[model samples]
Target: MSKRKKHNLQWIKETLELKEDHNWKSQPGTRIFVAGRGALRFDVPQDWHFEPDTKSFRFLDKKPPNDDCRLEASFNLLPPGEWADFPLVHLLKQVVRDDERNPIEQGEIIRLKRQTARIVWTQFKFIDPQENREAYSRICIGLGSGVQCLITFDYWVDDAERLTPVWDTVMESLVLGLYIRDPRTGLAFPD
Candidate 1:
């Protein structure tokens, strides 16, 4: 593996505290692989189509009919105290309002559960688009005395029952990475 891949693998292992016997292999698709501590492993389908501009991972389930999901991850580089200017809760509320393409109903926000971690509490939504079809999104923002990080996870499911565990694990792993501090002078990851 190349240095980037090797570094990601090691980072995942150490961050997630994976055991030696844990299976860590690439999944089918564009080789868009993600492995964290424990048995957490997932990949987007190679054949599934998506646009690079969206910076998202798309997948299609072969066994089902028109079943799919798109997951997008991005880092927001804010100045030390900039994040606090816009509260995490307000940021999410504004995103839902600004993006009419995905309107989150008031009931969805009321149903969201707040989860507190070392420096983050997530507000999540799992709404059924129509009978038997579901879509979910979670926005997690971490706060330090002077630093904050935001991570979002979105998934569409034909059945809501299959959504909980996978979504939970993925979001948890992403939050775990927030504990690592960047010492660089750049606002975001150095290109």
Candidate 2:
């Protein structure tokens, strides 16, 4: 018959370790979790994969027989006085306005529910360098399709640092997973 399915326990274990090492904090009233060290965080039913050499973490959601999503947050440690010189708010705006890449509208929020979560779409932008340029906009699509919600979280970078690039990559990755063409083909793990 069929071979045993390989479980991603290793990835899960590593993610826990990383979370502990960073003393990650969970946002109040939200399923999202964040590690301030590298501004690392991901949605629920998701896990993390760490690459020590690269000092990066990949947040992956592997729900079998349905959908999957991956968001990677990498750390590029800068010297005491050298950091990505870019405004985080500006980058957020760019991501949201890039409608061609992401279907986010300005000042629009949609509430959605999936089989896994009840998400709220709230626009946010913060100018914390340690956190770098951070922004999000779009529907809080989760749980099932019936309760899918839409929200906008557009933001941009105020500085001219390379952090925006990293943010862009992570955002694209997450969006792609959320809007997969076929759920059957979107499974990140086996049943």
lDDT of each: 0.38, 0.31
Worst 10 residues of 2 by lDDT: 142-151
Clashes of each: 3, 41
Q: Indicate which candidate wins on TM-score.
A: 1
Across 1-191, the per-residue lDDT of candidate 2 in tens digits comes to 00124444443233322322342333332234333221223433224322221333333333322212223333222234421233333444554565443332245443333233333333434333434533332322222212222222223433214233333333332221123222223222211
State the RMSD for candidate 2.
Answer: 18.4
lDDT of 1: 0.38
What's the residue-level lDDT of 4 in candidate 2? 24
Best by lDDT: 1
* lDDT, residue 65, model 1: 39
* TM-scores for all predictions: 0.43, 0.28
Clashing pairs in 1: 29-45, 29-46, 30-46
